[model samples]
Target: MNSSFSIGIPSGRNSSACGYCSPPGERSQGESSYQVAGFDAVQLTCQTYQGMIDRGWRRSGTWCYKPDLRASCCPQYTIRLDALQFKPSKSQRKVLNRWNRYVLEGEPDDAAASSQKSRSGKSSTEFVLPIAVHASEISNLSDESPTHRFEVTLEPSTFTEEKFTLYKKYQSTIHNDHKNSSAGFKRFLVESPLKDEPIPYPQTPPPYLPRQYGSYHQLYRIDGKLMAMAVLDILPTCVSSVYFMYDIDWEDHSLGKLSAMREVSLAREIHEAGVDNMLYLYMGFYIHSCPKMKYKGDYSPSFLADPETYEWFPLESCRPSLDTFRYACFSHPSHSSDEVITDEPDYLQVPLSSDDEKEIRMLVASGKRNFVVSLSESPYWQYDEIQRECLPCIHGLGIDLSKGVIFKI
Candidate 1:
C-alpha cells in the first residue's frame, strides 16, 4: 500500500560550487549555486515524490532540494521527452546500432561497420524501440556466435560486492575518485526514500520489465561481467533518470548514449504494456548555458520547465529567452529585466539574534502529519515577519503542491 504522507525534516538552505561551470578545487565567486530550501527525507510515496519534482525539487539519496535558479550561476531547467514522439537522430541511431553490432556481430571490419543497419537491413524511421533495443539479445539462437553476450537486468538498489567493485573502478577511472567507500556509494546511489508502489498494469509485465514503480538499478553485463549501471526511479507518469555509471573499457561502445536510448525504450514499453501515462522520460536538469548539458535539448520535442510558472515549454522556443537571461520565463517571447524573480531578504548569519542564545528554554510545538495548509490563510500572518519566510516557499512550490506535502518542522 502507498503511504499517505511524505516525511522530511527541513534543512533550511545550502550553497555550493557550481558544477556546470566551476573547475575542480576552484570555487569561483561568481559561479556558485544556492538552494532555497532542502530536506532530509525519511520516506515518500511515488505520487508525492512526483508532485515534489513537478514543483522543481530534486533528490540526491535521501536529501531533496529546490534550486534557487534566479540567484544561481546556472539555472537548471527540468527536461522531459515524449518517448512516443521521440525520433532518434542519425548520430543517436548510429550510437545504438554500433553498440548492438558490437554485441551481436562481434568486431565488424571497417567496411561492414559502416553498414550498421545489417542487423535486419530495415532502416524505416517508424520503428518500435522495445524491438530495436532487444534485437541483439536474441543472437544466441543464430548460427553465428556473438562477440559479446549482453544482458540488462533490473534489481533493487542494494549494496552488493560486485556492484561496489564496478562503482569503485568507475569512480577511479571516470571521476578520478579513488577515496570512495562502499557506505558512501550506497548513500549516493543505492539508498532511496521512495516507497515501491504496484504499477497499475492491466496485465502482469514480462519478467524482464518492472511490475512496480520505484527505485531500481538497471545493471548492464557483458559476457557475465558488469559493464554499466543506471540508477532510475520508475514514477507514476515518467521514468526519472537519476545517475548512470559504466566501465571506461566499454567507452568505445557509446554506453552512455546506449543507456539513454534503452531508458527511452523502457518508458515506451511500459506505456504500451498497460499504463497510459508512463511514456515520458525525465532527463534531469537541463542547464542551457553549459555546452555539455545542452545535449539533452538535442532530443526532438523535449520540454523545459519554467522556473517561475512550473509550466513546460518546447525546448526550441525557450532557447532565446534562456540565452538572454540567467533565469528564463517560458511564457514570454524574449527576456527582459522584469523576468528576473528576485527580492531576497537581508539574511543574518548564525549565531542569529542575541535572544536566540538566551537562557529561556524554548517550548516544543508541532502539527499533525500530512497536513494541508492553504494560501488563503495568508491574512492571519499578513502583519508578521513570519509571513516573509513562509510566503516565499509557498510561491516557490505553488499553492497546490505546497499543500500536498507534509512539512515537518
Candidate 2:
C-alpha cells in the first residue's frame, strides 16, 4: 500500500477557552484565545504523520493541525517516552499487577487491595468489575490457571456498537461530556486517513490477534472482556497515542496510567520484533500550565520538543524554562519571545526552482494574495518551501500571510 497523503491549507481561526491559564469565570489577562491552523488530510502516510507529530502537529480524524506555539496561552509541547528504557515504578507495577490479576483470576489481588486502602483510604471493592461477557468472553472459571490468559489485540479504526457504547459511557461519566454523539465519537476516534499496513511480528501472535499497521484500536482484555481501548497510530519511527478511553466504572484501576504504560510496552515489543526505529511512545501534547496535564511529565526520562528548533530536550531541562513563561522556546537565549515576524527562518527555506519562482511571481502579480499552495508533489521540500519561498514571496507582495493564507505542503 502506498502510504501517501494530502493536506488542505490551514484555516479556522478561533479563541481558546483557556482552560489552563484562566479558571471558569475569570477572563484571561493575556490573550484569551489562541489561533489554530488546520489541514484536512487524505490518506496520510505513517512516515508523514510521524514527521508531523515530531514537529508539534496533531490530528482530529483527518483534520491535522498545530497550535500557534508562539501565541497560544497554553503552548503545548510534544512529549514522548523512550519505550526501551522504560522502568515501571512501584505504583505503576501495582496498577499493572492489579489489572492482570483481576482479569486472569476474576478478582483483585489481596496485596493490591491492602495497598489501595493504605494509599487512597478506599477499598478495592470500589473498583467495578466487568458487567457481562459478550462474544469475546472473559470468564471467572478456569480448569488450570493459564500463564498468559490476558490478551491485547490491535484492529483498524472502525465504528462498532460496543466501542461507541463504551465511548458514550466514558464521556458522560469521566468528562461529563454528554453532548458528544455517536457521529462525533466516530469522527474523532474511529475514522483515520492512514492506510492499513499491518507490520508482521517475528513471533507467533495470539490466534485472535488482528495485527494491522497504520492506525489501530488496541483492545486490552482479560478472560475475554474488553476492559480498555487505546487509539494509536503505528508508524515507522514510533507509536503515536491519539486518544484513550475506558470503562469509567473501572476508575479505581487507574486505567489512564496503565494504558500509557501498556503503550510503552507495546513499543518495546514492536522494536524487539525488528522495527528498530519504533522505540518511542508519543503521549501527545503536554501543557505545563495545566495542572490536570502535569501527570504526563511523571513518565520520567521523557523528552519535549522545542517549538522553535523542533529538537527534543529532556523534560527536566525544559521545566525551568516553562516555569518562567507560558511559551518557552528552548533553542533561543530568551527562552520566551512573543513577537511575530513575517519573514521565514533560514532552516525553513527551500531552494525554489525556476518554475516555482515564476508561478509565485504570477500569483503575486495577479493579486491572488490569499491562498494555500499544495506541496504534496514535493515532500522533501514542502516544509521548507512553505516557510522560505511561499511566506517571503507573499510578504514581499504586501500580503500579510499570517492573517489567513496557509501553504499546505
Candidate 3:
C-alpha cells in the first residue's frame, strides 16, 4: 500500500486566508479541515511551508504549525496496489534474471538491462539491476517475476563506526559530481548546539528526513550485509521517504524498488495487523520536466493532491489541463475538494536588459508576446539545457530564457 497526503501550499487568495497566520492560530468556521478518507483514495497538496518556517511558524513532526488555523489536520492515506497485476518491461526482466543468477547461483550478472545477447550468447558472471537509477518511480514494481518469500525485520541502525564507513561508501558511490565537501556534509548533520559532545552521524541520524515529518530512522539489511537503508519521517497518517539509497553494486537486485516495495508491504502488513490510518507513500514530487521523475504518477489509480480543494481526482481525468494554471488547481487535492479549479496570473512579464531589448522589440513587433528568454533578472542564466531540451517537446512547458522567468502558461 502506498498513497499521498496534502501539505497545504497557501495561495495569496483572499485576505482573510491570511488571518490563519496569527499567533496561537485560530480556525474559522466554514473552513474545511484538510482531511480525506481511506488509504485507497488518498491525495495531498504542497504548501509553502519552507517559506512559512521563516515567518515563525513551527514544525511538529511533518505538520507545520499555523498559529491560527487549528482546524487543519495533516491529511494522509495508504493505497492498495494490485501488485500481482503489474508487468515488468523486457529490460526489467533482464535485470531481475541477472540478479537472480548472481545472488542465488553465484553466476556472473549482465551489466546492462537491454538484452543484445552477450558476446558469447551465454550468460556471464557480471550482474547488475536492469533498471536505471533515474527510471520512473512507477516502474519500480513488477509482477513479471515469480514472487519469493523474503524476511522482514525492524531494527535501529547500530550506528557503529563500521556502519558509518558504509554510509560514507554509499555517499561516495553516488556522488560522482563531488559537490559537497567533507566539512559541509559534516556541518549539515549538526545544526543545533550540543553540550559537551556532538551528535553522532550514522548513529543518531538527522531529526527529520528532508521532506517528511516525525523523528525516526531505521536501517534495513538483507542476509548479513547492509544493502539498503531509509531515513524516513513517519507522520500521523503517512510515511514520507526522506532519503533512500541502495548499493549500486546491487543494481541488478533492484534494491531500490525492493526498499519501497518492502515499505509498502510493511505498511499493508502493519495495517492489517493493527496500525491506524497508515496509508499513502509520500515519494516526493513527480516532475515531468525530469523524465526520470514522471514515474511517480504511474502507480494507479492515483490523483494529484489538488492545491485548492484538498481533494483527489483521477490522474487520467486531468490530462487536458496538465499544462495550464488550471492544472495546478486540478492537480491539488485542496482545490479539487472545493471544486475550485480556477486560475489567476501566476507570473508577471518584466523587461529584460538593454542589450536584449532589441531582440524583445523584434519579437514584439511580430506580435509574439511569447519570447523564450529573460522572464526574470538573474546575474547568471539558469535552466538553459532544460530550455533546449524542452523546446522540442510537443507539450513543452514554455521556457522564459531571457530573465530566467517561467510561468505556467
Candidate 4:
C-alpha cells in the first residue's frame, strides 16, 4: 500500500517522567522512569502505522512513541489476539446474551429508562438478572431471532457533543480522572492521522447499519441509545483498538472484555468477507507489573511483540521471562541481558541502500515534512561512517535531523 501521509523525523534523544511508574518514594530500583523521543505527525498510512505498532510503537492521537522498555521500571509488551480462533468465555457470552435480550424486549418506559440515567445525564439500560432472563427467553427465541441486540456501527471519528459527554462521564466515574477536558478528549480520540480507506467488501449489513471506514468509532447501541464506544484503526491486516469507554452504570456488563471480544468478532467477519490479513485484534500494551493492565493477557491465544527482535511470541511463553525480569526481551533466551539490537550504533553499517537514499531524496525534494522507513537500528553518526554521508543530503533538504522518527528493531 502506498502511503499518502508524511511524518516528521525527531532528532536527538528525549525522555519524560513515566506516567505508570513514577511517584515520590515509591519507585523501584530498576523501574523505567521515562519515555524516549518519538514522532509527532498529523497523519500516517495504515501500513506505516501497522509497522510502527509491530515494532512496539503506539500513538496517542497523532503522537507516535515507544516506551523505553529497557530503562523503565514497568515494561509494557504489545499484545494482540488471533480473532479467527476466538471463543468467548462463559461470562463474555452472558454479557452478549443479556444485551441481545434487552434489544429484543423493546425499550422500557421513559420513567424506568430515565431512572437509569447517570448524574451526567447519560442513559444506561441495566440488565438485572440477565442470566435468569436468558434461560427463560432462550426457549421462545427462534433460530432466526437476532442473538445480538446491540448494533455495532463504524463511522470515521469526529468531534461530537454526545461522544464528549460520554468520555467525560467515563473518565470521572471510572478512573476518577477529574482532569479530563473536551479539548483533551478531542486531541486524544477524535483526531486521527490515518487516512480513510474503507475495505472494498460488499455491504450486506442488516437494514439501518452504517458502513465502516478506516479510523472509526465502533459504537454499541441498544435500541438506538449509545451505551459504549471503541476508538479503532481498521487497517488492511488488523483492527487496532486505540481506546474504550463506557457508561459506568453498566460496569456489571464487563463492557471492556465484551468490547474486545466484539472486535475479534469484527475482525473475523471482515476476513470471512474476503478481506485478506484482517485476522488479528491488537489489544495494545500489556503491563505485567501493573495489575490493572494485566487483564490484557486474559484473552487467550494472544501474542506479545518482542521489544528487541520485533518478532512475536505467545504470551504463555513470554510470561516466564517477565516473571523473572521486569523487562523481557524475547529475542534473547533470558530477559536479563541489557544488550539488544536497538543499542547497536553501527547496526546499519552500509550506506543507506540506493533505493532508500533515492526515496529519501525524493521525499526531501517534495518538501514532505514526514516520511516512513523500516528502521532496524537507530541512525547515529557516531557508529556508522556511512550515516555521515547522508547527513549532507538531509541537511541540504532542510530536514531537521534532531527531531525525526527512528524505530529500533
Candidate 4 lDDT over residue span 328-352, tens digit each: 7888866554322234234234355
For model 2, residues 18-99, the per-residue Cα lDDT tens digits are 5566463122254555544455655565655676777777888887766667667677889999888766666775576566
List residue ranges in candidate 1 displaced over 4 A: 22-29, 109-112, 116-126, 138-145, 333-395
lDDT of 1 by residue, 13-53 (tens): 55655778645212224445555666667778888788778
Tell me the lDDT of candidate 2: 0.64
Candidate 4 lDDT: 0.63
Q: Is candidate 1 or candidate 4 better by lDDT?
A: 1
Each model's lDDT comes to 0.72, 0.64, 0.35, 0.63
On lDDT, the candidate that comes out on top is 1
> In model 3, which runs have C-alpha deviations exceeding 4 angstroms?
1-102, 107-153, 156-163, 177-215, 323-327, 331-409
TM-score per candidate, chains pooled: 0.83, 0.73, 0.42, 0.72
Let me know the TM-score candidate 2 reaches against the reference structure. Answer: 0.73
In angstroms, give how far residue 363 of model 3 lies from its true place: 55
Looking at model 2, report the run of 10 residues with the lowest lDDT sum.
Answer: 127-136
How far out, in Å, is residue 28 in model 4?
Answer: 2.8
Misplaced by over 4 Å in model 2 are 1-5, 12-16, 19-30, 106-143, 146-151, 198-212, 222-225, 337-409
lDDT of 4 at 305: 88
The CA lDDT at 236 in model 1 is: 94
